[model samples]
Target: MTAHLSRRTLLGIAGAGAGAYLLSACGSDEPSTPDGPQTINWWHIQNTEPMLPVWAAIAKEYETAHPNVKVVIQPLENEAFKAKLTTATQAGSPPDLFQSWGGGVLKQQVDAGLVKDITADVQPWIGSLLPASVQPFTIDGKIYGVPFDVGMVGFWYNKDLFVKAGVTATPTTWAELLTTVSTIKGKGIVPMALAGKEKWPGHFYWAYLAMRIGGLGALQQAAKDNNFDTPDFIAAGQRLKELVDLQPFQKGFLGAEYGSPDGQAATMGNGGAALELMGQWAPSVQASSSTSKKGLGDKLGYFAFPAVDGGKGTVAEAFGGGNGFVVGKDAPASTTDFLKVLLDAANQRKSAATGAVLPTVKDAADAIKDPNSKVVAASLASATGFQLFLDQAYPPAVGQQVNDSVAELIAGSKTPEQIVKDITKVAKSQ
Candidate 1:
């Protein structure tokens, strides 16, 4: 996930401690080039190792087109990237171009005048992307960033496990999902791979559950009013709690550190765990491993998060958005040119062909050769609405609080009601 900034100003101040890490990550790079050839610094959180080839291809294409411009790519882990971007922006040395999630986070930086308005620059390509991919990044009617690949977070189940448990189809309702998990558990296989130690991953359950229980209108209203104490919010927390007692998660998953290939490979390959309510990012894990779970592809079955049986919400409600580029205030004009070169139809196609991304540029989805990539593209296009990653949308303090509350729920120390109350309190305070 990426957040964009203008020049170097950030208005919504996180606590003092948060600023320290940001400062270090955004540390000034030596002025590598200035007059002869413009060099732009690009930071992103596309951490997949396989994606390295795609990035290299992009760099090569851009360099060929813009002979005088150079793009230095810096790929960081998600949290670390966010922290560094924040620190660099605060300290006045932000990168020329960076990747960011678009929504409230982008809005915050926009309000701070930390990011440039690229709407005019990208207008020619606006008609290319699926309309939904552009919606989340649009603020007050202007788009702040380009939409790259759009993805959804939901349940991915192992077909082999489902067959062993005598389940023939994916569950379409919350009740059915629960029943499926219970049946899988009875068959001696853990039914879900929930990661609690990495709180953001834990937060996804609450986010999707809240959408399922409250409906998109309700969730949006709550976000607008910062009203997490509402009954619907409590209901979401309660739903997550129910799953914890079901003990459907893999053993030690509550303590699993996310982004660790070892963790996912171990649980899915050897452990009798059947499903993971994770983002599209999970597939790369299986694909990268040498274990039996590797190369799952379509065998990695998926279903949209189900509606709470008979609830106001529909099964189509999903969490989704894209990872794309943003220019910094301090960047040279060549940086924008460089981005354009990299995002050209051919280069975008190359990225899709490599299977590391779905293009942010219009018509780029057609270049995707991998069957699973096509499936992911179709799923993204059909989504009803997308939420930027929840924690990413919340201000730091509030996001951290929401994260901790989920952890406590998993620990059995907080009820959904209490969790909602805490979140509402922080939302109001903001």
Candidate 2:
């Protein structure tokens, strides 16, 4: 979903573009402080516990501190939020502050004149947050969103299932991973759980394979050249095809929903599958969706996506994105001011304490108490490189194309060469 420059340099690059915007009338680029009571409409996706109440409490506290500003909260489910936001932005209006992953979507909004440039407004404390986490929000040297959480995707496996299958070690290489899947399936165990109904989940396999084989810059270069017809990308598709041909996923996986009772998370949590390639949120989702509602607990393990034998990218390069908030074009000035209060270290700690987020505020790290989350935090801390999810990294149309093409590959309805050709056509048009 993203790329960025050196630490603290992202904002500093807002020289000419931001300067031009400042000189132009535009639409209140430097919004004035509120002169009277104002309502800030906020739309988020933390509709459930650990975060839902936390957000409410934060808004309440902010209102108490600044009676002149009223925060109107609207929490929607993830997919629902995306659809609604799409409709609103297309209609020429969005919530004052809304949920944003801050890559291609944010870029699209910016290009469409739907969001604000808050670089100057956030200058004072933006440096206190993790630079990498902020990277996705910075497009063309200007900051459009503020990240509250950051994470990466990896293999979340059932350690107990691995033991039962006699796979004593986690696979560190692609070849070994294939062997591990085969051994697990041979034991009559489902080797993997995938939400095939959701094209995004299936795309992870193809994206990671590309990252490993083509290296970190491979995808970026493709976007720059408006082409995916490359040997490395073709190899990525071919590798994913090899895995698909193994028939390692749970039955009905092709139609399974991600958070449904019989979905990918439930399958993994119930020990129906040995592993699932998912984001950092996997454990909690598994627990909530599973019959026990307690997940696998200590039996769950996280490992980096395995390396292809002759790959250029290392296991240390991470692939994921996290939540952030972006200001709408018509938002009142108090919106940015309230964001300062909302993202302060103390408030961020409240979020981290819930184990629902990998806090972007550096000082809030100690609040993470969940064991699985702790491992994920440590992994992100040590990552040598980072890339936002492929779907978010590219333009909206190109990103969707990537997901659709990859899903076709998994369905055995498309070849690697065809995947490249399809994506190239879309990317070139964009």
Candidate 3:
């Protein structure tokens, strides 16, 4: 989706409250549980196979246990759900429970008084989750959301392809990465599979480059100061440009979708590309999108993003985010209770078993059967610094600018200096 559309949607919700529409059928003004049965309106983005059935089964179990509670579910595609939720929140009534990425968007909801403060309600079991998993949901030392899945972004490569390219070890630094790309290209294999049409995937390169060059504090400082025109950010664009100059991506990559048959994940899963920089869900997406409907089984391997020599960031620092659920301010008290059941170790294990999510519950880690997922989980656990996806870390306008500018840079239409200036302009305006 374009930045204009996203910003407009968020703006609508930001201005909502006084003259917004209310859900008359749901009795908006009544106490959460007054006279009769209580219904929980839930909206989630797991509308596809594996997760769809898993979540539905869980909801059924919850309803069976609580005869007085009625759980209403509305499964939506990611962008569709976001747009609908934006309208609902603007109408002054959000779902009782909804998917949350736990970043600036959640912060906006919190500031608007749309989300509930779940700190107290989850205090007892919150400690059972990984600290890193909960970090994003904590604002001003108070929690507003609960994470069920947590992970980081890294290179998912085909071991056989690496061998074909004569690459003996995974690159650990920027210089080595370039060399690896060149070697892979020499072998006549596409060095990388990128979903350029989906701007977020391309932004991963610039974002990770910035993290490697300026460190995690640089991102926070830029957001705090509303400026991104720093030397470090400029250098990030320059380094990313260096990679683009090599023309390492698959042919017609600029129009590629993320999970489409000919897109990034499928290209990698089909062994048509050497690697792809993606999150923990990469393997699952690859498998689902490929012709065989089964990605390279044991041949797929994982590695952390390479460090940039002389840069402030270490290989230990990670860039990524995960999925969570937030409660609406007017949600019934039973909402928290149901959330507790959803995130219980056993249920989390069930979710993890799908080989789709990296569980947040500490004890549920053992349920991760996929080797690649285990690698990602281990990296996240040991990460010294964490950064959420840029698009999720900033307001819609600023975040979208980052994506747009990076896409321009990759297309050879914008200079590093121009890209940072453009991003800074949007940041300041926001």
Every model's TM-score: 0.82, 0.87, 0.89
Ranking of models by TM-score: 3, 2, 1
Off-target runs (Cα >4 Å) in candidate 2 are 1-37, 77-80
- lDDT by candidate, in order shown: 0.67, 0.81, 0.82
What are the per-residue Cα lDDT tens digits for candidate 3 across 232-310? 9999999999899999999999999887789888999899999999877788778877889999989999999999998
Q: State candidate 1's TM-score.
A: 0.82
**Clash-forming residue pairs, model 2:** 1-388, 1-389, 1-393
Using lDDT as the measure, name the better of candidate 1 and candidate 3: 3
Clashes (backbone N, CA, C under 3 Å), per candidate, total: 12, 3, 0
Q: How well is each residue in 1-430 modelled by candidate 1, as lDDT tens digits?
A: 2121210111111110000000011223222334467788888766555566577667777778668877788877666777899898888777888876666667777778777766666666566666666666666666656655666666777888899999988988877888899999999977876556667667778878888887776766876788888877888887888888888877787677543444543465444478877665556655544256465656667777888864567766557545677777778877755666667787778767765566656567788776655666777777665565566566656777778888888878888888888988898898
Q: How much does candidate 3 score in TM-score?
A: 0.89
lDDT of 2 by residue, 1-430 (tens): 1111110011111000000011111233344676698999999877777688999999998889888988999988666776898899989989899988776777778999999988888877787776667777877778888888888789999999999999999999999999999999999999999988778888889989999998878976886788899999999999998899999899998898787899888999898999999887788888878999999999999999999989998998778777788999999989998888778999999989877678878888889988888888888777766677777788778888888899899988999999999999999998
Q: Which portions of model 3 miss their true places by more than 4 Å? A: 1-37
